[model samples]
Target: MKVDPGTLDWKDAYKLLIGSVLPRPIAFVSTVDRDGHCNLAPFSFFTGICANPMMVCFAPMIRGTDGKKKDTLSNIEATKQFVINIVGEKIAAKMNDCAIEYPPEVDEFVQTGLTKIPCEFVKPPRVKECDVHLECTLHEIVTFGDHPGAGSLVIGRVVYLHVLDELFENGKINSEKLRPIGRMAGQTYTRAVSDTFELERKKQPGK
Candidate 1:
């Protein structure tokens, strides 16, 4: 079936995109306004960009109904700091609770009953429930689409990282211990630690 994104409505196209992108790693972002109002939210349009300078990026889209930017985006824009908390299966329910469209003054950490830990470099606090926290400074924000549901890709440079001591094994993070949760389409989620498999990469013949 051939589907043209231009022809489809925004909602339909969004659904298709989310459904096809299987098991996307969720970034439970935390930020604070100038008055120190805390905001917590989850975004699946997130990934690591580079290791040389330690960079990460997450795309937060505008509301389709009102075309306004999310609180996280606004805070990051104002303060130029934010924290990306990696979501785990243990706090998945609380993380989901943050998906609500609360007013800007609302404190999601208090609403969801999640503990917030002070970050070293950023003004925003990190979710204590999440095992890993990436303290970041805003590098850039690239916007796409002018209408409602438009997206702004927020690029941040990781300044500090806090990882649970037990989740670390040898030199790497143990997936079994991390037990990260992934996002799917329409309220669906995936357990990244389950049914895992490993495949060795093959070397090129010329090499």
Candidate 2:
């Protein structure tokens, strides 16, 4: 069925976007407030936008209860830095706790009982339990749309990477070791280790 996206209402259109997007990676972002309190949140609308310079992005939509931007986004904007912690099956509980709509002053590290290890490059602390943590600086904040649901796309340039010693294989970290988890529509989540496949690009005629 053909549909004109421009004509569709916001709620309907948003539903289509989320459902159709399939399983998107969760960015358990950690940013520090002006008071040095840590704020953590999981955003499914997150992805690695580049590799050459190592960049990632996520948009934390405005909170529906207040029609205002969440604390995570605010902290990132103020500090111009954040830690992107990879979500895995083991950290699911803590990650969920961090997603709560806590007040700006609330420290997610304390609420979730997650260890906050000092970041080597950024001010924000990294989730010590996460298999992978990326220390990134704000690359840009592209403001788009107008409604409350509208958001500023936060682009961060990853300058440092923290990998668990056990997850490292050769120069890379194995997916199985990471046990990464992704987000689905609604309250559903998926574990990568449960599903995977191998692929190879077609060979070109010229060497």
- For residues 3-68, write the lDDT of model 1, one tens digit per residue: 998788889889899989877999999999999999999999999999979999999998887888
How high is each candidate's TM-score? Answer: 0.97, 0.94
lDDT of 2 by residue, 61-89 (tens): 87766778889888988899999999989
Q: Worst 10-residue stretch by lDDT in candidate 2?
A: 143-152
Top-TM-score structure, candidate number: 1
TM-score of 1: 0.97
Best by lDDT: 1
Worst ten-residue run, lDDT, model 1?
A: 143-152
Give residue 105's error in model 2 in angstroms: 0.4
